[model samples]
Target: MVGREGVAVAKWLNSLGFYAFVLVHRFPNSETGAQAPLDDGRRALKIMAESGLAPKGISICGLSSGGHLGAALLSEYPQVWTSPDPEMPQIEFAILGYGPISTNAAGRTIIENKPPLPPKEKQELYDVVQPDVQLRSPAPPVFIVYSNNDPVVPVTNAYRLAEGFTKSGAPVELHIFADAPHGFALDSPKELPVSKWPVMCEAWLKQNNWIE
Candidate 1:
């Protein structure tokens, strides 16, 4: 399941009896921008393995900035976590929301969290934050979702992620909603139909045997 930064969807995962881990380490407090969270994902996954939570494999799901880190965990594992322990669980599945995957500031049509023209440090941050530059081999299957009306993350980000997946011969599913906002499913449980995302997610996981 995916949600905003610090939303703690892991609690719901635990209530369902699935072992869950939340990523609490990152540079900027916000969910968007830069590579600090990718840096944090390494440590988080390491701890998960040390704590015996990610053994055979693990599925990652995220939103916007979190989604970017999720993608980094899968495709750019080499960069994110440099653990000498090759036992790091391979990311089996990833579900991404409106996130900027590979491309960084200079690569995208819409740039975020910066001035009209990016300054030096911000540019350096974007450069290092670009996942496309760090794409590694043997990528895992992915499900990507995006909305055209999302003011924060535009539709192109999803398109680029799919493109990278196909180019690398990785399995991928891209879903586009015509008019949902940036954090459309923020509180989906209170709503109907859309709240069924968890159901759909479970069905998908079961079909793949990721969860029994």
Candidate 2:
């Protein structure tokens, strides 16, 4: 969260009058592996809810892998919160910036970051952690932005996510720019159309009545 990209995005959101919280979530290489991020994100939402800083409820936003974490929170919330605590804060919406959405992409990324694991264990983990597969009906609204020319995470990830949410009967908006490399964040050149994502996202929030 302390990275330049995160700080830039947070400042931009704050300037727009949104109480943006940059979460420094745990990495997949940690002891809990892939589950570490979900645990941290859930706890962060709980804290934000108790703080009462956002009367309109909290929304999750992330770039690249961070976006995957936010999406996971929405997709896996039901199974993770089996006890059904009424007080548990739910994500009002999600904004994903070039996130890798497929299970193979996620599993491959994790394996690259962490120590080598047995093939069987890796496949099992991949099978269980697919956010697109687990996306159920009545999902929170999602705003996705990506560049078709992104070299890191393919645009297919974005397409698959949009398809998943649409199939699940959730309100979803997707914007695909013709250019812009991966991890563009808020630093995309002004000349590039991808830089308009923040403005478009703000409009989306207003359209959904999340902000005035």
Candidate 3:
């Protein structure tokens, strides 16, 4: 669903001189199971680290479900089963664009398939994969952008995420536009204030020394 959007963002970030990669992860479904996406993410980061392009630590920017994947990876969920690889690179920062942070709330809906997982199975996955619930100490600095009136993902999810970061003593910047639909991406109309998110994100990156 987000493949083209991911490509667009990567191209824009590249124009800004960032070494970015688009991770087209497998969906959390009956075939691949719940942990599929996050495992792909962790592996992707390991590959990026091996590439030696990110000398100054890596960053993650994800849209929608991809955002949830990034957060879950950062949160290091199912810690017993998913210990960090010895050579895994540090995640310096993250940008989440309208991620569904609460598994019981918005996230479950995203992962629920046509022939949804059995309730017991679903709850077990949710318990260990919630990013807001699992936010750890020294949380990576985050920049979040979402529309207050987003029709698909509740705006409250953004609040929950920011609150998690705050409680973890992590630096977080959140911007909620008064109105916009889900998945506007970089194509938000110029008249809509949501279109300015990229500019705001760039400014935030510069202020945090993530970019010049």
TM-scores of the models, in the order given: 0.76, 0.82, 0.86
Candidate 3 residue 158 Cα shift, in angstroms, is: 0.6
State each model's CA lDDT, in order.
Answer: 0.63, 0.73, 0.78
Q: How does residue 86 of candidate 3 score in lDDT?
A: 33
Tens-digit lDDT string for candidate 2 (70-165):
676777553533322334566778888887666354354422454334454333334455677677467889999988988777787788888878
User: What lDDT score is found at residue 18 in candidate 2?
Assistant: 84
Give the distance in Å from residue 125's predicted Cα in candidate 1 to where it truly belongs.
3.4
Highest TM-score scorer:
3
TM-score of 2: 0.82
lDDT of 1 by residue, 77-180 (tens): 44442444444566677777777664456645465553422445334455555554455566777777777666667788888888777676677777776766
> Which 10 consecutive residues of model 1 have the lowest summed lDDT?
114-123
Deviation (Å) of 128 in candidate 1: 2.4
RMSD to the hidden true structure, all candidates: 4.6, 4.3, 3.6
| Model 3 alpha-carbon miss at residue 183, Å | 0.5
The weakest ten consecutive residues by lDDT in model 3 span 107-116
lDDT of 1: 0.63
Q: Pairs clashing in candidate 3?
A: none
